[model samples]
Target: MERKKKTGFARYINLVNLGVFVVVTSVSLPIYWLVISSLKQPVAIGASPPQYIPSPFSFANYQQAFSQYGFSQYFINSMIVTVAATILVLGLGSLAGYGLARLPMRGKTTIMLTLLVISLFPGIAVIPPLYLMMRTIGWLNSYQALIVPYTAFNLPFAIWILRNYFLGLPKEMEETGRIDGASPLRIYWSIILPQALPGLFTAGVFTFTACWTEFLMALTLNNSNSFRTIPVGIALFGTPFNIPYGTIFAASVVAVVPIGILVFVFRKSVVSGLTSGAVKG
Candidate 1:
């Protein structure tokens, strides 16, 4: 009877898990449908009782999108912006975080609080001022317009993330480095940074993702086709007689490739960094 009860309990748990999986899968159907329909013609997608599967898979959309839209150039612009932003966040955020966490500064709390408060404002609200500043500097419609401003905007949040993780770290590590005759930069570079991999990776991955999918800022800052990013390119697919559904979908899928790969590569760091932050004071 005890063995039977144990078996029944295990079976019940398995059934519950299956039910949950099915529900989650059902919720994801629309997104899956969108991706699938991106491979089909607009007419087929607009038809009643929409087709989930393409009758004949097509690469024409991808070809046309690349050939006509300068999607390749847009992709390159995105890559440059994302890479530069990620590197800046990692280096600058880490250094700033280490200083804030370890080094003493007069009125540090007041300044840190001010920065944190300013950082909390939504990016949309800052757009007007940011655009004006960029314009004054004659950076409007250039990659520099996006790169420099985005780094500044994203820096504070990255600083906070790294600072929290740095604060969580015990001072014993830095002390050990000091006893070994390490200077501040040496300690940060050789000792503290190596151990802070998870935090740095978390910041880097987040920055990369943000920089990649930044639609409003990219759209507002750039007007020319050659300077546009993937999101902006995708947005232009709407048309009167020929809505380019397939092309948009294909581009979107391509856009997701880098984000997906980055997440896959650094997923471990994300999980660890998050769990550490939560469990610590």
Candidate 2:
């Protein structure tokens, strides 16, 4: 009876594993197909029943994306925008979070709720005002146009994450710093900051991903070919006359690579950040 029960439990575990594998594959198959399709020639891309493998694998599509359509410049623009915005978000968000968590305020709860509400506002709703403000300030077609807005829009979530993480930290160290005559900034820099690495990385990764994948603001804030980021460049890849599916697919795969690499690198930090507040320690 014991052996039969163990066998049944093992079979159930196998079934669960199979279900998870199926779900993961179902989601990943499209991405797999996209990557495979990118390797094919233009002629093979749209072949009926779809060619599972490239008939003659070629790097021509990738070359066209980078060289002919200027993905290289778009990539640089995206990097600048993503890196700058992420820095801004992490800096401002950490400071804001520290303040909200540590400082005594009469309406702090209300203030945090307001921030959460502000973050929930539709991005589309703010575009007109943001566009006009950027135009009025003569920041149009500038990296600042995208970077600044991305920072502002992503700040609330960063602040929320960091603040919750901060709240979970023991106050003993902070109190000791206070007695040692360390300035508030010094305490934050030395005491709180070191302990908050996971939170900072979490906020930074979130901000980076947001800025990297952002499209609407990228499209609206800049119109110059030189200023366009990857999304816009990819969207406008083919003329109205011809859509280069292979090149588009190749560009998409290229675009996804950086984000995947980033997440893979910082994945441990992200996991730590998310789980930091779950238990007492």
Candidate 3:
């Protein structure tokens, strides 16, 4: 009977391992293909037989993406919008989260729920009014057009994450700061925020990713090539006559690098923030 139990446990472990392997392989295969396809020569990209391994890897696609396709400008535009939006989200979110978590505000739950509902609204639903507003304010084809909307859209989630994190922090710290005569703002800036770094990083990374990859707003808001972002620019890469798949793949790889680096660097913080208040001992 003991031997049979042990055998069953071993089989279960093996099955779990096999499942993980299959999941990893399924997700990684496309990424592998994208990388290799980006390295392939333009003519070989659509070859009669697919080149799983790029023979004589060429960076010509990358070069053309930057030089001919003006991906550099698109990249710069995306960086500007993403960074600006993330900064605003973090700054405003931390304050709102702290207020909601610690302050004696009435209807805080209602406010939070409303924000959540707003966040759930489809981007398409809001675009027409947003476009009209931007046009009315003369913000179309400008960085603020994207930055303002991105900040507003991402703020609610950031606040939700940060509020939960703040709730998990000990109230004694704030009380002690008050005893020492530290201002509320000082306590928040120096005491609470330092300890909430993980939440902040998580919020910032999410906001950056959303703003970076956003398409519909970036597409509809800015028609000028000078103001175009990576997603829109990539979409408009080729004319009706010819599409450059290799260049598109190369641009995609480049676009993915920043997000990958960010996730790799802040992975621990993201995990901790996500699970901070999930379990209580």
lDDT of 2 by residue, 79-107 (tens): 99999999989999999999988887788
Question: Which residue pairs in candidate 1 have backbone atoms (N, alpha carbon, C) closer than 3 angstroms, thus clashing?
Answer: none
Model 3 reaches what TM-score against the true structure? Answer: 0.97
Better of 1 and 2 by TM-score: 2
Which parts of model 1 have CA positions greater than 4 angstroms off?
1-23, 238-241, 278-281
lDDT (C-alpha) at residue 48 in model 3: 84
Off by over 4 Å in 3: 278-281
Clashing pairs in 2: none
Candidate 3 residues 166-200, lDDT tens each?
99999999999999999989999989999999889
RMSD of each: 2.9, 2.1, 1.5
Rank candidates by TM-score, best first.
Answer: 3, 2, 1
- What is the overall TM-score of model 1 with all chains considered together? 0.88
Give the per-residue Cα lDDT of candidate 3 at 219.
99
Report the lDDT of model 2 for residue 190.
Answer: 99
Ranking by lDDT: 3, 2, 1
Best by lDDT: 3
- Our model 3 lands, by Cα RMSD against the true structure, at 1.5
Runs of candidate 2 with Cα error greater than 4 angstroms are 1-12, 278-281
